[model samples]
Target: MVHYDERTPHLHYAFVLVVFDAKKDRYKVSAKQVLTRHDLQTFHDDLDQDLKKVLPFYEKGILNNKTLTFENVAEIKKNNDQFKALKDELANVEENSNDKKAILKITNQELNEVDLAKKQIDSFKQGCLKKHLAKP
Candidate 1:
């Protein structure tokens, strides 16, 4: 839902996080799996990518003030520090995600190689058995 309360039009979106459970072979409402830290972190980026494909004019950014509002300077400083720390954590998470993807690609390649070798071995065994039967 788009709200007019804010300075700019922003989506006040709400939906149940549903994921397909392979074990059950059916879709289930599992917020714990779908609404993950990684999912939340990448939500805006993914949304922006899709939105751009449809709405070319959709600008990517927050629709509100960027300032960290607080009564006291000390409290403002504290909030700023917290925000910085969270940003750092997000960067680290993204970095780790990239590393993991690279690792998975290599692992998949190795598994494919193993599968090919197994198929070749089986074919060779069948050929040898056929040759032996023909000789007899």
Candidate 2:
């Protein structure tokens, strides 16, 4: 997802963006919000123009036939777990901002270690898959 905001012709309000992709059984779906019409056409046009700059490549790369490397798979799992832990931690961090950053830093470091393990496992799977693909 990508976003850019305009400053002129508006000062306080912000144009927003939300995008998501979901895959199921050989079918992929994508959704986008180009404009919300929170203000006049000028503000909305600015958002659309910015989206035009950002959306094409994103749509192509994510929508097209792309192959995931072992690193990519590992990163995905790592990010997922990191986000999950972050979500939980945010609930308890309303009081201690200092400890929150420290804990988050440690959590991210641990996530990297797990990511490395996942990368190794993915590499092993790719090796096995490659062998099978090569067989008659």
Candidate 3:
């Protein structure tokens, strides 16, 4: 879904991106607002280029045959569990406590791990998409 606002001289656009995660068996939908029209084309071009880069890997069957192994799934689940634990600990910490910063840092690290896991799943989804579209 996409919408354009042309109330003023400048134009603003909003669009939704739907990405599938085959490993997790879910869809990750994100809505983005583009303040400048010029950047919209750049965003589309960048997205296309990124998908193109993954095509060769998909063709090689690396991403097609095994999107996520047992180990990968376990690692992702472990990271998610660790992130939840850290978030709970951070919430219990006092605002003025000296340990707050350290806890926050650890929480951020765990969040990054979760993000990486999501990226891996998304890449696998892209590969699946390519394979499906390529089939006659």
Stretch of 10 with least lDDT, candidate 2: 58-67
- Taking the tens digit of each residue's C-alpha lDDT, what string does model 2 give over 1-136? 2334633122234444544534334433322344433433255356556766878742222212243333456798987898899988986675578788889999999999999999999999999999999999
User: How many residue pairs collide in each prediction?
Assistant: 0, 0, 0
lDDT of each residue in 25-71, candidate 1, tens digit only: 99999889867667766676677677878886877554235634455
What are the Cα lDDT values of the candidates? 0.82, 0.61, 0.65
Preferred candidate (lDDT higher): 1 or 2:
1
* Best-first order by lDDT: 1, 3, 2
How do all models score by TM-score?
A: 0.51, 0.27, 0.29
Error of 3 at 90 (Å): 20
Which candidate ranks first by TM-score, i.e. highest? 1
Predicted structure 1: lDDT: 0.82
List the candidate 3 regions with Cα displacement exceeding 4 Å: 1-96
Query: Model 2 TM-score?
Result: 0.27
| lDDT score, candidate 1, position 48 | 68
Top lDDT model:
1
